[model samples]
Every structure is written in C-alpha cells, then in structure tokens.
Target: MVAGLLGAVGGGWLVTRMRLFPALLLLGLCQALVNLGYIWLVHSGPNVGVMAAVVSAEYFFSGLGSTAFVVLVTALCNVRYSATQFALLSALAAVGRVFLGPIAAWLVPQVGWSEFFVITALSALPGLLLVVALRGAIDRAERARVH
Candidate 1:
C-alpha cells in the first residue's frame, strides 16, 4: 500500500513533467488493475462474504468522496482562478474521511466480497465513457492551436 501510494505520487509528478497523455493513461490502467487485484486477494481469503461487504462499503464511499471532490473543485474553479480553486479542492477532500470507517463497518454484513469489488470496478465505466466522449473535443482543441 505504501509503495502503491508512493508510486502514484511519482507517476503524477512524471505525468506533469512530461506532459504525456499515454503515461497518465497507463497510470490509470495500473490503478484499476491494482484495485482489481486487491479485490481478488480479499475474496481468496477466509470470510469471503465479510471481506466483500467491507471492501464494498469502503469503495462505495470512496467513489462518493471522489465524485464530491471532483464536482466541488470543478464548481469552484474559474478557469482563471487556479490557486483558490485548488485550495478549495484540498479542503473538500476531508469530507471523505468522515464517513469512510463507519460506512465500511455498516456495509460488510450486508454484501459479499466478490460482488462488492465487481460493482466498484463497474462504477469506473462512466468516467471512462466521459473520457471517450471528450476525445473529439480534445482533438479539436489541439488542432485549433496548430493553426
């Protein structure tokens, strides 16, 4: 876990410095694979049902937290206001921690491990779709600048 976090930080820095889309894409793919691996590991252990429930609750709230952060940050940003935008983004990140533990505890008994991770993995599809849809706009923006 520590290594993964450190690697994420390093990957983010590298992406920023290199301004490389493929690197970011690879990092995102790696994160998904890692998450899937974690789910597989949990399911393979004893108490599969309990583990599934716990992981499900953990990731559900995590998704909510991530969504809230993204929305709040996007709303606060002025396109021209970088500093204040990012600061507000940082503050909103704390909202996730408040319910993370309790949610996990509450969810474990209700859902099994395999289904929980599978659902979480499926939730990522919407974001992927959004990126796909935006590809055309991104290409247009790039093309416009070339002229």
Candidate 2:
C-alpha cells in the first residue's frame, strides 16, 4: 500500500513534467521489467523480505504504469466527446484485466512460473508499439489543447 501510494503520487508528479512519449515508454518498460522480480523470488525460495520487496515493487510500477496509461488516454480524447471517449477507452483498457486471468492460469502450468513471467514481460511490447504509432496523434492532440 505504501509503495502504491508513493508510486501513484510520485509518478503522477513526474509524468506531468515529462514529455508524453518518454513518460509512457519509461513507465511501461519499468512495469514490464518489474514482473521478472517475481521470477527471482520464486527461485530464491521463501524469504519474507524478498516477497515484500517484490510485491512492493510490483505495486509501485503498476501504479506508475496506470498513471501513464491514463495520461495517454486522456491526452487522446476529443474535447467534444471527452466523457464518452474516455469511458469507452477506459473500458477497452480493462479487457486484458478481464480476460488475462484465466489465460494466465492456463499458461502458468504449461510454461511454469519463470517462462510465464518472461512472456508477461514481453506482452508489454505491443502496447509500446502502439504508443510509438500514436506518438504523432498524441502530439497533435496536445497541441490542439494548448492552442
């Protein structure tokens, strides 16, 4: 909880000051890499300190990534349809959260924890690719808002 709180607040502040792409890319990358920490904990065996640290780091990065994602979504919204678009986009974003659980459950047993985490980390690539593709659009939108 403390990690989450710190990440959310700190990330929000930091991201607000950053250029859009850098902030989003950094947060997304960090979030992806953080999942690998769990792989270490699993192999290292049960140590309460490591478990707490890994969980905290996960929460921290998740909070940061969530903030970055919201910023991207909000930045891309049209003012005329801001509410509806934001709602729709937000719901679309939750699709993975809604479906990935059962998928992960099935996957974990098949690949084991270490490989599962590697796959999880790699899954961030598609989103990062989208961010790259949308960079121009996001810049245009921000420009529209400012001017």
Candidate 3:
C-alpha cells in the first residue's frame, strides 16, 4: 500500500515534470537503487528495521517502475491495436520477469549475495540505454499523451 502510493506519486511527478524517455531513464535508475538496499542487507546482515525499510523501498520503486513501463508500452502501442499491443508487451515483460527469477537463482550460487545484487543493479542499465535510443518515439508519445 505504502509502496503503491509512493509509486503513483512518483509516476505522477514524472509525467508532469519530464518527457517520456527521460522519465523512463529516471524510473529505471530509481528501480536500480533498490538493489543497493539488498546489497546492504547481504553485507550487514538484516536488522528488522533495515529489512522493513528495504522491503518498502523495493516495493515503492517497483511500483514506480511498473507504472512507467505500462505507460511506455501504452505509448508505444498503435491506436488501432492498442489492447493487443499492450497485452503482448505486458506478456513479454511477464516472461522476462519469470525467467529472470530462475536465472537469479542460478546466479546467486555462483556469485554470492553482494555480487548478485550488484549484477541486479547493473541489469537496469540496458533499459535506460534503450530509452535513450528511443528518444524520438518517446517524444512523440509524450506529445500524443498531452493531446
């Protein structure tokens, strides 16, 4: 609940203040920030307070990132096939999330917790880079979103 609220607020702020691609890059960066919390947990071991805070932070950022992603997918969709495109994009995302879980499980054993989290953080970069690459499309989406 708290995370959802924070995420909505973050999303609202992003749409109002920044263009789509930049907002997406920012959202990805924020999403990546949560990995540091997990890294802290691995290094310091978990205290109840830190654990709670980290969990909330993770959820908040996840919510924000998810919202931004949904918006981006929606923006990218053709108006004639909006529903199908959104569903397809969302399904692709779900597949990625599902597969990543297993890959993470495999990776954790090889890398240890801290490195795993670092790798997790690094994973966010590609999305941000993609946003950079798609700046033109994003601007068009932003314009469409406005009017």
Candidate 4:
C-alpha cells in the first residue's frame, strides 16, 4: 500500500515532466515485466522476503500504470461530456480484466506458472503498440487540453 501510493505520486510527477506516450509505454512495460517476479516466487517456494519484494514491485508498478491510464483517458475526453465519456472509457478499460479472468484461470493449468507469466508479459505488447500507433491522436488531445 505504501509502495503503491508512492508509485502513484511518482507516476503523476513523471507524467507531468515527460511526454505522455513514452511515459505510458515505459510504465506499461514495467508493469508487464513485474509479473515475472511471480515466476521466481513460485519456483523458490515459501520465502516471505521474495514474496514481499514481488508484491511490492507489482503493486507499485500497477499503481503507476493506473495513473498513466487515468491521465490518458482524461486527456482524451472532451470538456462538454467529460463525465459521461470518462465513465464509459473507464468501464471499457475494465473489459480485459473481466473477460480475461476465466482465460487466465484456464491458462495457468495449461501452461504452468513461468510460461503463463511470460505470456502475460507479452500480452502488454498489443496495448503498447496501440499507443505507438495513436501517437498523433494523443498529441492532438493533449494540445486540445492545453488550448
């Protein structure tokens, strides 16, 4: 919880200092890579230290990524209907988790922990790619917010 709060504050500050697209992409990659810590935890067995480190890293990065996501979504909204659009976009953001929960459950048994973590890491690529592709759109939205 402390780690996550720190991360959120850090992320908010970092995003203000950097370009949103690159910051978001970097944070997304960090979030994805952090999942690999679980692979180590699973293999090492009952070590509380490793577990604490992994959980802290995971929460920290998750909070950072969430901050970036909120900023991106807010930037994308128009002032006229910001409330409605933000609500809709926020709900859409949750679709992956809601839909993928069962898939993740099934996937673990089929692929084992390490491979599943790898795949989870790889799953971040598409979203990152989408950010790359939408660079122009994101810039335009940022400009709109500024003006």
Please provide TM-scores, in order, for all candidate models, with all chains considered together.
0.50, 0.93, 0.90, 0.97
lDDT of each: 0.50, 0.89, 0.83, 0.93
Residue 40 error for model 4, in Å?
1.2
By descending lDDT, how would the candidates be arranged? Answer: 4, 2, 3, 1
lDDT of 3: 0.83
Best by TM-score: 4
Residues 1-147 of candidate 4: C-alpha lDDT, one tens digit per residue: 998998899889988988888888999999999999999999989999999999999999988999998999999998899999999999999999999999999999999999999999999999999999999998888778778
The best-first sequence of candidates by TM-score reads 4, 2, 3, 1
Best by lDDT: 4
What lDDT tens digits, residue by residue, belong to model 3 across residues 1-147?
A: 787788877887776677767778888898897888987776667588888888899888888888788888888888999999999999988887887898989999999998988898999888788789888988898789778
Clashing pairs in 2: none
TM-score of 4: 0.97
lDDT of 4: 0.93
lDDT of 2 at 112: 97
| Global fold similarity of model 1 (TM-score) | 0.50
**What does candidate 1's lDDT look like per residue over 1-147, in tens digits?**
443344445554554454233432344344344455556567566776665655554454344333333433443455678678778767765665586568756666678665565655665566555545655554454344334
Q: Give the CA lDDT, 0 to 100, for residue 49 in model 4.
A: 97
Please provide, for model 2 over 16-119, each residue's C-alpha lDDT reduced to its tens digit, 9 standing for 90 to 100: 79877888889999999999999999898989999999999999998898887887788789889999999999999999988998999999999999999999
Winner on TM-score between 1 and 3 is 3
